[model samples]
Target: MNTSASHDPNCIFCKIIAGQIPSKKVCEDEQVYAFHDINPWAPVHFMLVPKAHISSMAQLGQEHAALMGHIMTLAPRLALEQGCNPYPDGGFRVVVNTGAEGGQEVQHLHVHVMGGPRPWAKG
Candidate 1:
C-alpha cells in the first residue's frame, strides 16, 4: 500500500475501506479492498477497489499503473474464492465503469468481478 494514498470523506468505497462503513468483505490488503456487492449480478459478484481515492478511470495515469495491475491480479483470484469456477473454461468478468456515460454509479475506481452459471442479471 502506498502511504500517500488518500481517501475522500464522501466516497462510499472510501468509507468502506476505512471501516467507516460496513461491508461483507471478501478480502483486504494495504492496496485494495474486496467485498460482496449489495446487489449481486451473479452467484459470485464482488468488487475490488483501490484504497486510494481515485474518482474514476479518467483520473488514472502512469502513477496508477501498479495499483491498477494489483486490482486486476486480485480480481479473478477473489472471484474464484467467492465460488466462480476455475480458469480455461469456468471464468469471470471484470467490469470497470468509468463515468456516468459509462454507467458508473459510484465515483470511485472499482472493478466488479462477476461469475458463476449464467442467465444472471441485476434487478
Candidate 2:
C-alpha cells in the first residue's frame, strides 16, 4: 500500500481497509484489498478495492494508471486462489460499475471479481 494512502472517513471500503469494519479478506497488498462480497452473485464472488478512495470510475484519471493496473493484474490471481479454474477450463469476470446507472451501490470504486458456475435466469 502507498505510505500515504488516501481514505474517506465515510467510505465503507475505507473502513474495511482501516480495520474498522471486518471483512472476509482474500487478498491484501500495498495498493489494494480484496474480500468476499457480502452478497455473492456467483460461487466465487469477491471485491477488489483500492486503498485510496476514488469516488467512482468516472473519476479515474491517468494518475490512477498504476493503481488500476495493479488491481487488474491482481484480480485473476486472487480469483484463481479463491477457486476459479484456469484459462480454457474456466475463467472469471471482472466488473466495474461506475455510477448508479451502472449498478454501483457503493460510492467508492470497486471491482467485482466473480467466477465459477453462475446462475442463469430462466428462459
Which of the numbered candidates is closest to the native, going by highest TM-score? 1
Model 2 lDDT, residue 71, Cα: 94
Please report, in order, the local distance difference test score of every candidate based on alpha carbons: 0.87, 0.86
Candidate 1 per-residue C-alpha lDDT over 1-123 given as tens digits, one digit per residue, 9 for 90 to 100: 322349888889999999999999999999899999999888999999888888888888888899998888888778888999998788998899988999999998889999999879563
In model 2, state the lDDT of residue 80: 92
Q: Report, for all candidates in order, the number of backbone clashes.
A: 0, 1
Best by lDDT: 1
Candidate 2, residue 1: how far the Cα is off, in Å: 23
What tens-digit string does per-residue lDDT give for candidate 2 at 1-120?
222238889889999999999999998988889999998888899999998888888888778899899999999899899998898778988999877888899888999998886562
In TM-score terms, candidate 2 sits at 0.91
